[model samples]
Target: MTSEKRSIAVRFFGGAGNYTTVLEECCTHILTSDPTEAALVEWVKSNTKATSTDGIRDRLRFLEALELLEIEPERVRLTETGITWVSQTDPNVLFEQLDATVYGFETALEALQNGPKTDAELGDSIANTHAEVNWNDPSGPAQHRGWLQSLGYVERSDGLNSLTDSGRALARRRTSDSPNFQRQTYYTQADLEKAFDTSFGSYIKGINPRTDDHGELSYIIVKAREDGPYSDELDGERFTYIGEGVPSKGDQTLTGANKALLEQAEGASVPVYFFYQPADRSDLRYEGLVSVADVRYVSADERDRRVYEFTMERLDLEHPTEFETLAASVTAGEREETDSDANDGTNAGSEPEPALTAAEDEYTEVQRRVRSSAFAKRVKSAYDFRCAICDRSRESPAGTVDIEAAHIYPKQENGRDFIRNGLALCRLHHWAFDTGWLAVSDAYRILVADRPELEGYEEFSRLEGAQITVPPAEDEQPHATFLAAHRELHGFESV
Candidate 1:
């Protein structure tokens, strides 16, 4: 393997190895029964952290290959390799990384252990612990608290700001001086796997051998600090400090002078690398660069294939027409719901209202056009560029028949483009599904007609109520009115 490949493998292997050492030590201290029971308990306790003794046996299976320690009914013993590796590895470095990653929950756990705090209290604690203390800037606390919440760390639940288990671990790890504190203190090997997968493990697969400028495959990686209100300070000290890429690129469809203005900003997280793609002259198609979000891993060996190469997770925004449709429907529904609830003395005005400012109007237009170009991309991610309506799959991201997000209700008839209107359908299905000859039932089930044109129609029956895979849900939810209306109006009962 190339040095890059070896490096990638080594990082993954090392993180896993470090976690094993920590698990063994923690387990030994916790379980003192039969050696076998102790081994099992050790494994479970390692994954569960200092919290509870759940899933000890299952977690042991996860780290079985490490063979850090051998267990028998009567005695427990460390393996030769485990002993040597543990002695050599730096516990502090491993733990710090683990704290930021696998043990990220530790931060929250620490807070929870002390008892629940309100959002303001939790935010204050997080700010005090994580945010830079800017003596010149007094508003630092609010800013950092919002940032932590965006990343799914501390959340407000039942009127209190609480740390997730991951958050608790992170908080606890922060107290350690060892760089490897997290390395030796993970909640589970699986959690470590996921972190590495999202942040580094994926780099091993699909990362191109070369980087491109002004190409669809190009990415700009930068470290961004959280500014207040979900905005990114792209140019200042708060700007992203990416190792190999810039904070922003010209080609990404979402590229604005800044994108933090969108409604999605409130929940935005910082210190993440944003990915982008370039579009051609027609502005009709935007080639996708990666299917997953940008991962953070330091590549070693510049000449090695794995070094500096990267891929991204897929993100498909709903079609503009559909987005407009959904936005309108949501607005209308909110109005109706509000009016109905108004008579009952309840204030139904808690939701954020969509403002139709000039900038927002421009954003609306941009989102619409880009949604179409992003169609093929949406399908690629759903099943590696396969037709969800038809079991067609392709290894090549560009080789498949382009699938589009089909709307159950026609936009012309006032159907919204929310996720419910969005379906990853092949070109043929897009046409047939839109024409109302084929309809979806009120229960969100698919129904095909008994047409002489489509022979061996067992295919249609198989698709009824078949769950349609989609990109990660992005606030937009599937609405029932459109599907119900289509079926009722068409008299097909399946619409």
Candidate 2:
């Protein structure tokens, strides 16, 4: 086992003067809540950190290495190996594991056997005891003192580290068993507010993105339902998210939320965390950390105007579409109900509006945009993501489906968002149908306008009477009312 010790400079373990109490408390916190990165940072700032926000995460990773907790893309949680120690009256099981893993454990014991040593001397005695791996006080001696104190093997007085009675026995015999050591409970939320030095209540948005006062992007929430106002589409490994803006009111310009996400594509180091809100619950699930892969200004087929679309690449989250039953944290329970202003577009709440100039107008438009997205998704799914006109289906290597949902009677004409009023078409046919070049008959057959002189007519005319592929559910099929209205509006002869 000693031969398998990490060959790197990880001579010491733990982070920023971490203690056994800190590790045990954090592991226990993971037992009841999803330990999202944001929450964990907040926790460290309050409980640790006399100076800055540097080593908080390292402490969490320390807990991970201790086999007391596990970290995922979205959140951290307690491990079953941790389950035994968190509830045990004595933490020697974990301390013994630490004694086995961390170097310099016996060196400190052996040195203190002679007499008490000053903190500096004790630190020196422990440093570089192992071959080629060295560490500073915070990662090395400070952490060593902390765990030693936790195990009741050491005590400190006036800047000195000395073995206790147990420590002396352990020092003399080089072995000791600890008495029962009761630990205190951890308050994750109270700790969070205190650490970040801010008051936080429940957020009232469906999607919330957190940016600091300095305008740094922290994380985003992706809330999905089978049919919802916005289409945050998950295709293969790529996530195509509609930028926050309502398209029905006018053209979507990339400003507010759209701009922030677009900027993420530029910096690879910028970590954009993702949280998933299950439609049926108020609590959110951590999807994982993601980075922006691509952003586009699109002339959307459904909206008939340009809107920003953000494509995101998952870093470590593989099964976002599948959720495991993980515990919810303070971040989840504190969420309030309301969603007009959920962040520039990670869909939003809690942060100051960066695009305040257009706040009122934009909020009003968000509702319409969400509705339009839901309609398109419903229509597209009903047709199994295939183009009805030519019966062609295609998906990009990037996992993007090429089919689009089209409105038969037209949004400009105030057509309602009903299943019968929509059709799934490829981009070519979608444009052709919208421009009056083609129509769908009440008999569900393809109809092309009398344009023998039209380009591509030779191939298109052959499909004149071909039946349209439709949804299996009768309720989802195209309605005769909308089809007849579309035929008449486009100058198609009655069938």
Candidate 3:
């Protein structure tokens, strides 16, 4: 649409720009604010390390030519495209625009497709096609290289420029005859592998939990769709994620990818990057960083097993990682620990510190409480706020209910907070279950202790062989595992 009006008149900085950092910062400043041309320069001088406004002008002109900025007699502002880019800072949007609008982008990419080349080779290839951009022999190509490196499309080492994984994908797309130009196909697995320095082979479609070459925790790549039986859902700002599962008969425990995600909820410092595609679609579109908000082990109807469900709070970060377009997403460095310098007079420095810092310990506790609350809510909802034994439902005009959530296996015995391991009970039944005077058979039949002295035995004996109420969803039903554990512990196994 902007073809006739736009031209390659704006040339960018020459060589690997030392001012690239300042250039990016200045670009963000311009995109986020409304500043006149003169004011833009002054803002850069006051906010950044640049002594001169030369760098700011160069950045502005480059952005303008890319159609990311709109200039007028009255005021200057970012275009629609520029607003989207600044919001996520996704470099893919910017680079794709450049490849189409800018003259040398495609040429440089094509030249590098053959092999590694010096700036001279890249410049000459571009000059042969579009000769308008030049000051001297290498000026055109050097500027091209500077822009490429800044966008993370190409890298220069040992005086030669090579296409990064991001650049190669762009190059392939430019030369390919395939017309599948969907957004998710922007970057492939190679780009993700190179971005985090992670060398995991062949990622499974949904979740790939991995460690880096340093044998340290890296990241978890979750490829999901928006809506389906098992698709991940973005609920407001928190992403609801279901863990990986198997087709086996038994329940899915917290292991493998499930365990990897649990580590973060336990206060492990690792980033969880989310990507999504349409249902039954290939490839993925990158979303941003997410912090583990809560985790729970529960049954999924489709999988017919208890899997980990993670509640991840999306994070808005200033720095995105080096992956194509996702650079607007995030990049995290490994945390450094140094306590060797703290040597007390007793030489107690030989001992290791506690696993978590105070803040992390507090966060873990918070997650535990959140999981407990979720379990209780689900159990109460499943039983309709009625006791499984007495079926007594208490409700007030204020919407308060008298139902209590009890753990069948007991939390004091290190039992996990799981829906199937929980029961909704009135105060009387809750006390009886905890006292081993009342229990549920593996068949879900209520059992009353034969002890004649028991207070509720006469009333409970009426419904001894009757089935308890359960949730409509089969997965929400209390599992036989928890039932058997309760029965055995209470010496009601023969009942």
Candidate maximizing lDDT: 3
Q: For model 1, state the Cα shift of residue 111 in Å.
A: 11
- Write the residue-wise lDDT of candidate 2 on 220-313 in tens digits: 4443333445667765556887766664566665454555565455323233445454456544444555556666667777656766677776
Model 1, residue 86: C-alpha shift (Å): 59
lDDT of 1 by residue, 1-495 (tens): 011110000111112214344454544443343355555565544544433344444444323333444545566555554454356543332333223432112334455658776545544454455444321233432333333443334566566666544345345445532112121132232342353233433322111221234532222222222322123223322222222223232112222212221111211111112322212221111221112222223323333212121222322322112222333334444454435433543355553222111122323443333332243233344444445456454322212135455555655654443343456666666676776546665444567666646654665656656655444553233344555666666667534
Each model's backbone clash number = 59, 9, 1
Order of quality (lDDT): 3, 2, 1
The models' CA-based lDDT, in order, is 0.38, 0.59, 0.64
Error of 3 at 210 (Å): 26
TM-score for each predicted model, relative to the true structure: 0.29, 0.32, 0.38
Alpha-carbon runs more than 4 Å astray in model 2: 1-364
How do the residues 72-186 of candidate 3 rate in per-residue lDDT, one tens digit apiece? 5445688888777767665567767777666777788889989999988886787777756542454667767777787777888999999876677566656753212223244
TM-score, cand. 1 vs. native: 0.29
Error of 2 at 216 (Å): 27
